[model samples]
Target: MPYENPAALRITSPGLCRDATFSSKHALHLLSWNIAGWSAKQKNLDLIAHLNKSDIIFVQEMWSTQNLTLDGFSITCLPATPSLPKSKGRPKGGLALLISTSTSARIKSLSSCNNIAMGVLLSYNTISFLLINVYIPPYSSRVLTDQAWEDLDRYITDLEAQSPRALLIIMGDFNARIGPNNDALFASNLWGGEVIDHYSSIYGRISKDSRINYGGICLTRLIGSRNLIMLNGLNQVDPCAEYTYISGQGSSVIDYALISQHLLKTILKFTVGNRQDSDHLPLTLSICLPERGRLTFAHNQMANPLHYTHKRTFWSPLVASNVALFLTSPSGLAIKEKITNATNPFSVLTDYDTLISKLKMSLMLPSPSHRAINRTGLPRWFDKDCLDVKRQLRQTYLHYRLQNANTLPPEYFIIKKKYKSMIVTKKRQAVHEGWKALIHASRTKNSKSFWELVSGSMRPSNLAPCHISSHT
Candidate 1:
């Protein structure tokens, strides 16, 4: 590996992305539900409002998300035309991810299939989350249903490959019952029987819809191939299976939250919650991340973690594939022309510098002249509220652990929401304060004073405690 952090290596290479314990961690609370337009009901509005506060929310079966707006969230919705015939209130289809704007979490490079799936790359300060929200309709024809799953798998696989180091989170209503603990047990009608009140992390779980269908088979295959660990039936698992969908017809744990197996340690709790005016319930996943890094937004899929050095000439990655692609790019072709037309060595050197600048811009990076700060140390903006929320969040986790509970209490979320809200406010306030200080210094016309300020900001935090390095 070129770097000490293994997660810096793309996930396509086995074991490379697995050991990223050094990467920053945060307590990420994700809620996945097939809302089915429950928010239209006045009584359910409060529940939906609370759900909207989650760090990351995946909403499926949207009847009217075309005009759907959630406060303090950035929405990425995959709209469906609702061609499927419906008789009742409204046709339901589509998927959405409401990522909280209250935090530094930023998402970009969204790709989606019409009402089927939506994929995005959500980045915190250091770690990236490749989030995919999917909804597979229960088509009358088994073939059609199977095909939907297939298309979704392809989309998910492609997205994962594109953002190899991102922690993958796939959730939403699958509408497929993947049997029980033993694939044979579903067929034989023995789900470890009554002996298995709540089996932990078992695949093909026994639910109201006990029968295994072909679509379910496809879903299980996708799960296995993707190296995902399903959180639906895991620690402290629900005794009743907490089926996500229910109706006169049946109830099943169709909605789920699946994370890459390597993220197992990060997962604190996965619990199910019910909301009024909707057939499908919500699945809440609490991940204990130790770090709350700054947020980043990307224009395209991120190539890799940025390497900070003084040299600006490393604009184009020297890898064979990158070199080949860059050489054929329009900018690369133009650079070649400049080289051929150069009248003298100095002019050639000037064009070479321009070439480097253009290449960095193409990669969505600042030119050599641009200075960017690396904030790996504790932030200066952290205030009392930030500390209090952090304390409460930790306390809540401690209480949950002491009780050996299967799910997080409501207080955890209450603290989580407050922490997110406070961070946004403090960061904005700090930026304004910083600029004011800078402006005052510059207006004084004291180069010494200005340089001193610059040097102070550039200096690394001497207070940073020593820790074991990945390198020997």
Candidate 2:
């Protein structure tokens, strides 16, 4: 059965999932990777570790693998539509999105064209955006015809037309190489001249080795028409200058993340991962989102006998007075006569639904407090002294970086070493103090205090310890 509620569709981690709330101060980390049919059993742990850092992830070519679940993520997979034509002996293409459990983002599935593409409307607080993940099949004279390209272009155009105000973010393996020189805004030093020429020669040049092939031309035109910014092209220097995809034919940059112009200022960083787990490396982006106010309600204590008694006592007198007033009213004469003349217990009883409605209308329950308790138990070592030291450390590091550019001064490293040592010493001291207090409490036979100390000393787990056996 289809879920009627959007929240009902969500699956939470079994244990130790953080209470996710929207915050404007922090940046949202997004990652996209073409895993090239992630089927290696041995690399599962490595892949999970890499994905843990990002809040949202888009993976392409996730072929043939089911039951691929992570500890702190909700996974949604879309496999290639069988109706689409496939090449003989070619592996089926698939895509997946892994959203962090510790995110306040609400996601609703949007209409998409089969498995070639998937779209989702994401809302975080007041901000809403449309994210489309697409995997354009490699151009082939025999297998992928012009019809495929036409379908993809049409889909994109329709998506834009539907949500004109939405901040659009299109990320995937486009199978299109957009050379640095094609967009004059990109500096020459960003990409090597030889690399551009090599791709141009292989793919056929459109305009002097700067733009290549029909795919590249289509993508460039799309970017221009949409007023979108190519994150890779905006790079001043290529952090990962090596090609994204490597094969017998050689390397090329086929993966891309094109976002709306409004998001350019919010971009904190962009980089391509150097991990060799797949032929294509991961592309990571960090962007700051608008801040939102956190709302939390105090835990309801109505289940407790003492709490129930207190509530009953507080409302009983008021309820009795209201009931008496109702009985004396002119309209209440019919009800009063009916109650007085009732023979059976059932005759005297009011309808359960109507009784509840009346009680709710007459009775006023206390509102739950909005103030949230601080659950993060910082160690005693994290005191004002430690805070002062941290401030000094930050200032020193910033000063050194500003003066020396990318190079760290020798004094900065010396101070960093000293800072690390100080933290270690303070932490050890705090541990010793905690142990001493625990021992004293135990010796004194203060059971409540001992238990409190023990519970307080324990650290909160961030990930579920056990693995989920079922995927669906």
Candidate 3:
């Protein structure tokens, strides 16, 4: 159970992951992460900044008693009611939801369940969604607790009872080890009503674990009855069903994203953060709303979360000596052309960070290039076969680790090496074809396809709003 460093887990531009592409403008992004303890420290702040691309963020275990604040977001924090006799210290069992203010999103009702779950109705863009964040207490599968089983059912009932019905988006750390999607695991009459397929429609989802716990059993049955799909392993995009929490005790995918089948189309890809500043990883679901989706934006250019973004400077050693010297010098760090922090080029300015941003754009805008590069997260050439292999590799790897054997079974290496080699060969052929297409496009003066492929390969698509100018 080796813990992967959060830094090594950071997802960067292009290349590997199939779901690392897409824009936030045409899509709604929901990110769920357990921060353990929320604070104002630099690492937490940096983590928050990195996650700013998400439109809706659900956080669990806030562990804070005071109200929390974040720019560009409307935050709601819910802390479990403590015992009457011991209510004087640090608050425990906290949950939070952060919605981007840019959306015409309004919170209608705030409610909770079994002191372990809470939800709010979100109305925006003419669509209504009941958003629930849950943090279930640990309970043994052998001795399932009544509270753990009934909390969600009761909460959903109360929230759905609101005047108009809304779609459901429930997510959080359930501490449930639902190994995989097995029809046998669920009782035939789990919910009294027969649900066709029992599993909601999901393109690619796979779970690696085979260990089903008390919470997992309850959750599986509950979602089965309600027609909600658990968006994690047991599928393709995240085939290995990456473990959310890892430790000496071993790892499992305890945290999850539960959503109604209706919201499936808009989601180009579903991803789980490989690392974060917590024991659990982050899960992000990107939903592409229609282009005409009613999103509120300030007339002020700066107020738009879209239309602009900050890209880190990529230092280059190939540039001319004089040009490189100036770029590396104290003066280059200043947007107002005044040298202040040569030690830190990323220092924020007080036009509340806007004035300096404009000045920097004016000073360092890139050379002109083609436009029309829409990042849709789907790789045009990556077909279903490639996806299947990735799914298998991940599942196998997880199984190997969990076995905890000193030596792999016979023929394991031979099979592993064969699969790896096949993937490498396929990757090389794909890259060659891509470059060939790029060259042909350039030769034929077909700029649209050329830039699309180029930009797609160069950087991962950001959820932040961005626009390319006519000048560049």
Which candidate gets the maximum lDDT versus the true structure? Answer: 1
Q: Which stretches of candidate 3 lie over 4 Å from their true place?
A: 1-25, 40-43, 80-84, 88-90, 140-144, 183-205, 296-472
Highest TM-score among the candidates is held by which one?
3
lDDT by residue for model 3 (86-149), tens: 5555556778777765554555547567557777677655467888988886865444555666
Score every model by TM-score: 0.53, 0.50, 0.55
Better of 1 and 2 by lDDT: 1
Q: In candidate 1, which residue ranges exceed 4 Å CA deviation?
A: 1-25, 42-45, 84-90, 185-209, 235-240, 290-472
- Reference-based lDDT, residue 54, model 1: 83
Candidate 2: which pairs clash?
Answer: 24-291
Model 2, span 248-319: residue lDDT tens: 344567778788866655666776665544667688887667655111111121122221111222557767
A best-first ranking of the candidates according to their TM-score comes to 3, 1, 2
Give lDDT tens digits, candidate 1, residues 1-472.
1111233222232211223443324467788888776333313334545675588888887765353445445666665454555433345686777766544554674678656898878776667889889888877886687678778888887887788899888898887676544444333332223332232223333333456655565666676666576666542333345567654455466787788866765655677764423667678877655344432322223222121113233444544456567879897998889888988774575466556544543453322211222231234576556666777776765676567554446776666667767878987887787677778889988787677666655523212335887995
